[model samples]
Target: MMLPKAAKDPSCGAPKHTGLLREELLVFRHLLGLGENPSQIRLGPPLSNSSLKDILFVSIDVDGPRDFKCAENSPCLVGISILDTRRLQFYMTTISVAAKTRSALGNVENLIKSHQLQVGQSNHLSYRSSKFLFGETRQIKADKVKTYLQRLIKDRFFVLVTYGGGAADCIYLEGLRLGIRPLYHLDVLKVAQFPLQTYYRYSLAKILDALKLPWQDLHIAGNDARFTLHALLMTAVRDWNYRDDKPKSKPTPSTQVTLSSIKTIAKAWRIPDQDQPSLSFLFEDHIIKERVLLNPETRKNGKRLRPEKTPEEKAQRRERKKLAKEKRKLKEARRPQWLFNLGDLLDNE
Candidate 1:
């Protein structure tokens, strides 16, 4: 009897490899300084000083002559990761079909042949990890990708362009600093989908388009990242314009008064006799204090105290105070009280 067919190893190693590849892609993209997709972009408050150090850019590119690869496809996928706000790291992987069928391998071979690039042929997959200071033209395609990625890191905006046939679907991700946390995500999506237009919008686009070179050549991973960055910048400038135009009431005269004038008025209004008196009395005592200060003996104390108001004024004040006190007392007396003992006491009475 066939010894219990050795239990099929449940661990079909393909998943593990795929998982690792996905992680590698994330890291690779991050290192390359690629902007996150519109959905992935995290818009936070002006990053706190503490968090500024951790800010970074990650980008992943899956490039083949075609977008999708079948099980038997041997198309190469180039993944890059760039780290801004710190050092950088770049990684590249070339995957080939593992199938044994002649038909499958034949299809892979034909696809590779169609592209006119060899199965193991390498493109500019290498990259520099130093802080990108300044550059005009990059020597390698990867370097050019890195330059665009840096812009995404600094601007906190991204435009994702999905190229299909001859046309492209443009998506812009714009980061915004809102006081609320949850709104940040919602706002970015809203802005990306429907951007506000302004004269500066064109300027932003021009600057971004000029900076993104490889993006213009290959509608691949790097290019998608560059577009995302452009969209973000455009969105940011537009947002700023919107905020500047937001309606606000003109300042009142009292509010707009200069600090120096306020200080002078405060000094002039001080009561010479009263020390830290009520604000109402402070105004009334100002002239009295100035008159007292002119006399010699009053000048000895260098302070003149304002006398209590006339009997009529005081009587009026007392009447107002009594009315206010009675109103407060009446309010307090009328307040409902839920007392457990009230029913029992009333029954006994």
Candidate 2:
């Protein structure tokens, strides 16, 4: 299956000779042993006849608690980096939706604030300010996270790309029951190894540096997703033959398109420039916090509301109180006159 070489990739303005090939992509997939793991990869979706441009590359990175066990139990920040190869454009959405409870406020606030603090300290991708900086940080309900993802991948065949083989992202998305699945699964971490020739699982930041692709603020789900997709594209363009040569600093066509698209989308959002602290409130789940605070009796810790006592239980409580009162009266009646006099003397003193 010899695929044609791209003459000119308008996305990055890269030379035709260095452009990506579909055959190269297939070879890359095979080299990574992607087809061997049916449990992790789905190869039966008839991608053989499809050109690389025909498939959507969806890169997902989810941010949850450090102890993130599963998406169901934890609140997730979803970062979706989408490359529509046909259009030669990129679309990204980094969602920071907190659970509809007051309990999520502290953690969500800290994540956004920490990222805000590190915005301009370094040129490294790890310090890349999020697209949210240019756009209004809109809040959405936690339940809507799945629907938002579904809307993006609907009516499209996408290849799911992620760092660390996306085991957690798969569980998170599947747990949401997205229904739509990727045509193929590509791991940027594994894809990177073929070029770097190491079994060690390097961090996405390190892999991006190794591939000579620019990375932005990492750990933020959206930025991570964007990085993952670009990393996969850059890895695809690499020659499988081992080379001691260091990767060039030039950005790929896919990366160029991604950055441009981000700016375009940010411009469309028309968010006014302000201090980071001022914008931080938008990312916080204030609506949920406000709702939770309205009830005076409600615990701020997000515990379940106490149910009203049943008639039988109330009657039992009353009975217990009566018995306690009677017992107290009996004890008082049994008290010695000397003790009563002593208590009177102490009170007078």
Candidate 3:
């Protein structure tokens, strides 16, 4: 779906068009790894009829392909995205109540710190600063931070990590999907072989230390995404190491386990299950679809979709066209008159 680009360079000026918020774009780019030069990064066209109204929050799933081990029972991720489209530049951070486990909290702290660094370095100035300088608005409120976070979680942008057993099961599922069989006996290694607790603590502590800064300290989405990715990678790396010694039936490439790779897998797995429908699907799926189809009929019925032109409106349009015609005529008339004048009229008289 087409998504709006974020404002990376304040020098370009605030977007005058209404739609996606600058902050949402920032978060999307961070998730997609597009970063500051998002304009150069082509995205699929904006989802048709999609406006800021449809957007509740944006999310990036950082954990491995499988849903969190206890994802059904507990929240496994945090939701950090924009809350309102009217103020597209602002961000709201949210964490799932189920994700409030000690390990999840650590990830959140790391994510906050990493984001702070990105904002600090990105050339795009903070929204408040831009508003103060260009829009002449007041400073941003401190409370918005918590509010934004809550909105993000409500929007499903964050994820919940499952229990240790679930995580291992997911890994096995990945192996099964790849068509690899165990090379050695399963009895040699324990399923709960990873040191998830240690990784979670280290990653969280690193992030919390970064978030100690003041609100004004964080500005860009790319930075936040980077830090979150860092934490994700740290967790993944540690988990991989923990599983390294285990004799698996089959092993997939490391790249296959990344966020992007998992999305591919998910899509492939989901494609066959999708219900098939016809053109009518457009009417049901899109708000504008029905309107666009009815527009011609409405016009035929003399119920103009747009406001009917008043006599004054018709007169103004006529006057405009007439003036344009007159201007052209005047130019042509001048040329002929000039030629006539250039003739020896005065001498002949």
Candidate 4:
């Protein structure tokens, strides 16, 4: 398999193989037990279309620099989940490419270090789950990611399925101008709407929750890719049954986890610790420069000394100030007597 050509490559023509529709591929993945364990899989009724056998289901997710440009300079982590329907087998893997530039390399290091911190902890699932999830992980230079993908996708009729929009995993491939010719492009995010009857969008984790399937270590490329594939399969099965008007009692449940009550978290799309910094630390001037403040006296030792007060507290403080002013005047009126007492004490000393 040749590496995908740049956008200007004349030899790269339009894709020749356009396989199944998004709808058909979704249903087919479910029936073939694509993402399930072989021991647990009990094959469902086959689809009418025999052509589905020839296609490969490739679901992918990527983790990269926050502001991604070309893949060459920036770091790239590609997670791929492949379902070979023809052979009734599936594989998950990740390809990590280090950035060429110092800044981009720092970003990559921070990302991996962050994930590594949660490795053995129970609180959050980390990329280390990739081993338990039984996926291979490879580290290479940023340029080689495309080559790896090209080799993996060689000659076979394939459908490229992704959790989110084209702007995600697809954009990296397109931005790098890696000439991947997929038989079909499927966005599970869009395909899921009608099947799941949801007007709102879903993240990969949220969708898995809706389907009553278990997902761990999201944003970890391989785990995300694997879950995305499973979500696709489950959504496809639901859509197929809904179209067939199958009885509610005969619903197909996911094989990975027991079909428990479906639960979804609000604001599930936002990853924790993803908020943008209030101040960019890249510029030294931004940190050292004096900032205009309403009360300059309130700032001390580079910290705010004054606490914010309510309206009632302010009124009470004003009343106290008035009392203190009267007391000070009374003390001043007896200043001569106090000075005389001080003189007598000095003489005794």
Listed in order, each prediction's TM-score against the native is: 0.25, 0.45, 0.21, 0.46
Worst 10 residues of 2 by lDDT: 111-120
lDDT tens digits, residue span 1-349, model 2: 2122322224645444332223324533442322223244444333332222345667777665444443255444566666554443212222222222234332222221111112112244233334533122334555676777777676777777778867777777777777777766777666565455434568988987766665555677766766566567556445323322323555444334444332232222112334333233334443322243445577546665778899999999999999999999999999887886997899899
Predicted structure 1, TM vs. truth: 0.25
Q: Write the per-residue lDDT of candidate 1 for residues 27-81, one digit (tens) a residue.
A: 2223222223233544333232222223333333344444232211333333322
Error of 3 at 103 (Å): 35
Give the deviation of candidate 3 from the true structure as CA RMSD. 23.2
Between prediction 1 and prediction 2, the one with superior lDDT is 2
lDDT of 2 at 244: 26
TM-score ranking of the models:
4, 2, 1, 3
The predictions' CA RMSDs to the true structure, in order, are 28.8, 23.3, 23.2, 21.8
Candidate 4 residue lDDT tens string, 173-233: 6765656466566688776765555545677778888777666567776667766766766
Top candidate by lDDT? 2
Q: Which ten residues in a row have the lowest lDDT in candidate 4?
A: 258-267
lDDT of 4: 0.51
Compute the lDDT of residue 79 as modeled in candidate 3.
16
User: Candidate 2, residue 105: CA error in Å?
Assistant: 40
State in Å the error of residue 111, model 3. Answer: 14
Q: Model 3 over residues 1-349: C-alpha lDDT tens digits?
A: 2221332334645444422223333323333232332344333232232222222222121222244333322211221222222222111113332223334333332222211111121123334234221012222222343353343344332222222223443342342242322111111012112223211222233332332211212222332322233333333333333333333544343222333221221111111112342122223443332233336756656455676789999999999999999999888876866576766877778
In terms of TM-score, which candidate is stronger, 2 or 4? 4
